[model samples]
Target: MKSNTPLIGILTSSKSDGSIAGNGPLFIALQKKLISLNGISFVFIPEGMEVDCINGYSYSPEENCWKKKSFPFPDLVYNRIPFRTKEQEETSQLLFSRLREKNIPFFNPCFIDKYELYQLLKTDNTLRDHLPETILVKEKNQLLAFLKRFGGIYLKPTQSSKGKGIIRVRMEGPSEILLEGINKQEIYPSFTQFWEEWNEELLKKRYAGQEEIESAEYEGKRFDFRILAHAHYDNYTLTGVGIRHSQEQEITTHIPSGGKLLPYHLFQSSEHDEFFQTIISIIGKSLSEQFGFFGEFTIDAGVSKSGRYYIYEVNSKPMSFDEVDIEERKIENLCRLFLQLINAYPQEKNA
Candidate 1:
């Protein structure tokens, strides 16, 4: 392999994703590591990719990865694309196809469906113990059975995040049913009323019926642990953990939906530390084996009021949170993993 700086392209939704502003400095960490080879560049590969005319953004506005001009494809790619970027649907697919044809090393080659993962992981002996009872909501019978058995349940969309389309249902009696949504919630006088309205909606979109864990809470809000993990050599390393506390009376602790993100250390006094870490290790390995390749994942897990730990969700393309330390470690690992991948796939021209 020739000695030359490798360019790393980060796939993102927009040209100026200020959300990633936090990791801007850490990109320099990559440059420092590659000083002997020249230096490294962090580029943002945005939506609306043009054929052969593909353009990317540099961390600075004046570089080749900037939006000012078209640039050559990078040596490695880190897909940060949100599965729901409706505007870039067709182009994104084409771009990925091209990347594969070029043999470029990239992670998260495709988006993962929540239902697909729920079914696959929940069956694993190692992961099932930490997985809450989750089932795809295929019919009215399933939802009713879960609510009746668990007394409280959640209907979560199989393709959503940020707590969108999460409906909390609880039965007070045969006649009284509570239906809680994102912005507003209500109680129906009868099961018939709740079923008539909700049945049609739930049937329209695929959902997962999850037994709601009355999680351990601090103050008045329920919280879940977000374990940020990334692939390291042959194993997964925990970048860090952060706590997402629910909004007052909210069913989910998604930060965008008003949930609070506290550093994981706040829960240091709890006795489940080892369990939580173990769960992360198992999941990271399990997902890697299942998916073939994974760069990073955010696991939404928490401890129950009864001291049981359960994993609620796994995000393959997790967004960066606003925490400085966690974001730094996450970016550091990303660059490290990119170097590993890039070095392994040296240019055939040089080979």
Candidate 2:
């Protein structure tokens, strides 16, 4: 028997006009790919408004009555919610909970619930080995100790993306550490110097916020890998891989920090070929078993001078597609994998 056709809903944030932010370039790419598939319909949901379940699209509050149409309910939701403030964060959680109670299939139910990801990884010893030295602490003593032991470290907000609110600390000498803002690049000689400089930068002289210190190197040119993993049928596959190289003095390879994305083949060499394949396989297995959410995920990983790959952070919802010279087969494989996952849900549920 043929399976039921799936109606996928993309839940995204609204612009000031209340329309969906679904027209972004990356999102457009995904939409185009999905549209190419047979028997699939796409619906959109914007925050702060109830969508109509008759039509497949909704209108913004700012639009005139003619544009204010109700959209149809979706069989599955692809969450693309962006959190800008504490209240928006809470609102997203509530919306996700409602979707769950309604029994709608969703990928990345809520991005704000990253604590669950951390908790899942904490118990996996083998997976933990691939991660860098990490700890959660709010005390200055803990930060100082981390800096002392690692010689260099990165201070980042627990809930930050695109490398915002990140600071890098490097040991300049036996007794001094150089602290610099990730974006501002303001330099300081010590923690006390950092406080003074930070106060001057903000012009209010107050403690900024909680920052997690991570051991990251900034002196050398750094590159990061974007490992795209997706579930196809019952197996998970690593789709297109890409590299991001820092073009500035930032310790991170995030695009916002003046980084450029390179093709995955750039890293494929006689020396690194074997290592790269092994790491990708390990990452795919780890994520599938840990999260239990079999969908496309982007894993950002870094390589040290010692030739070891360290998992930086796993992004549950990665930027969809980029305009690169990727092979047609790769793109087809990715699209096929996405459809496979969408198709597998009902079969798995029945079994």
Candidate 3:
């Protein structure tokens, strides 16, 4: 290992022309930060690479540009392959196996399965209370039973992100049902009618049924919280909390789904801050115990009308927060983590 200037690799998908795909700005930002810290950074795809050396784009500090170059296998890797299908490909799997065999540490290797994540957290007694009632919905009976129990439920594709493939159902009356999706809503006379019309969409993907969280609202619209955490050694550090509010009647508070980002201070409280930290610590411990090492992640939670919080999901590959301070801290923590991993930090600092 190059203790003074370790090589860091950012693994992401590539375009057909062999250019990087997704998170372009983030890759550049990471590279620039690494250079400022006197380390080397490269972005690489997982296919058609030699065992000892990789062909990718490396940042040149002197030229202030990314140049096509060949780099030896990096001391540490940061996986940023955005799509689940791409990450599941044979080539990507081979690359992961090679990294493991070589003892090259990486984080967020793959997306989390929604159902599995819920089940894992449900077993943690400390976290169980914050979780909404969730179940795997493979049959109509399962869906119907849950709807009867909760009166309203959310059907989410187990392997999706960014508010995609989510269907919200509300039981307005004993025989009346309301179905909502991204920017779309419908009224059905009965559950049977809705099922007959929507079963195909539900069956098309593996979905999980979760009891709807009655979220705290601002001016008749719902808002939720996103907590970003970075795992420092075995402990997770709370980098920032970002609040996103949904547009009127929207099914989700995800920013891309017609939701607006709000400053955390607009609704922040010391009690909520402490509550979020406790959840972060418990989650960090639970996930690390089950999934080995995780360097960064985000917890999505909703504050109910009664001021109680419910955890909606834990995202392994957290999206970049647009808040300036949060983004800066994210990059700083990431760079420091790389330094820590390669033993590049001073002995006193590490201690």
Candidate 4:
């Protein structure tokens, strides 16, 4: 039996390649799932993208690209815009304003901000304990002041990802400061000298000072959990959890930084499995409620030696899920999220 299935648009930063597979493999799996479920799918870019002024494109399954078949604007938008500054671009912002004017429902209402998230969640009694001491470094003095208190801290670019621009710092003595391994562990005689040369340049860019969190280690390397969580409106669930072990020289669990990914089930030493899921579910739900209408996220959480979990970071525009069998399940969950969103759109618009 034929039915009027609602269309879904998978959006990202990749430009049109005149082929169907424009948005990458994650969406390919998602597109298949949507089509199998009797829903239409098309991938598009926001740059130079005309939502055709209330128009859309068709998914050419053979070519794996949207190509140029005319349709209506999608019933829901799965925004996968990856760059931190993409939303800040005039054209991108214009696109968002247009989407709003069109009254289209989209996931991830706002871009992810590391410091902004901490400030918002700090008041939550359930999550505050898991957060490390984090503050924005608007002035050279502010970062240095934080250092004096913490003894050692990490300076991170607020808008950066993939463990880039992570500077490890500590004071050698009252007048001396040590910067760990940017080039080499260099020592400065005074904080002012350190500020003029290093801190001054860093201050020009937005950074946050966080107390160095001592995460749980396995086999002599520090490790953390990359828990995959999904939300359908207000309902949330912990879908997947993987452990990322940091490299010996650095303190990040990012896969791009030479960190290794391991299945959570394979880790014999992890805290009670239920404990990890409980923490991730609570954190995930808080984020979904704070920001409305989203499907998935990667909550980067650390475990202390005592098996207590701490949430270090969250990725809204997460890297594609790579675990075995998890990808298909994510697409299934995503379709459910879209179905609920599509069903509720009219009521939301009327109300």
Candidate with the greatest lDDT versus the true structure: 3
lDDT of 4 by residue, 99-198 (tens): 6766778877556678888887787887898888999887777877898998889888878776778878888866798887533577889888888887
Model 1 / residue 5 / CA error / Å: 0.8
What is the TM-score of candidate 1?
0.85
Model 3, stretches more than 4 Å misplaced?
Answer: 1-4, 16-18, 61-64, 344-351
| Residue 322 error, candidate 3, Å | 1.4
Residue pairs in clash, model 2: 52-71, 53-72, 154-214
Deviation of model 2 at 110, angstroms: 2.8
The lowest-lDDT stretch of 10 consecutive residues in candidate 2 is 202-211
lDDT of 2 at 5: 56
The C-alpha stretches of model 2 lying farther than 4 A from their native spots are 1-5, 46-69, 84-91, 112-119, 193-220, 269-294, 320-338, 347-351
Candidate 4 shows a clash count of 5
Please give the distance, in angstroms, between residue 78's alpha carbon in candidate 4 and its true position after superposition: 0.6
Ranking by TM-score: 3, 4, 1, 2
Q: In model 4, which regions exceed 4 Å deviation? A: 1-3, 14-23, 47-59, 63-66, 173-175, 181-185, 268-276, 279-282, 347-351
TM-score of candidate 3 against the unseen true structure: 0.93
C-alpha lDDT of residue 100 in model 3 = 76
lDDT of 3: 0.84
Instruction: List the global CA lDDT of all models.
Output: 0.72, 0.55, 0.84, 0.71
| Alpha-carbon deviation at 213 in model 3, angstroms | 1.5
Error of 3 at 157 (Å): 0.5
User: Candidate 4 versus the native: TM-score?
Assistant: 0.86
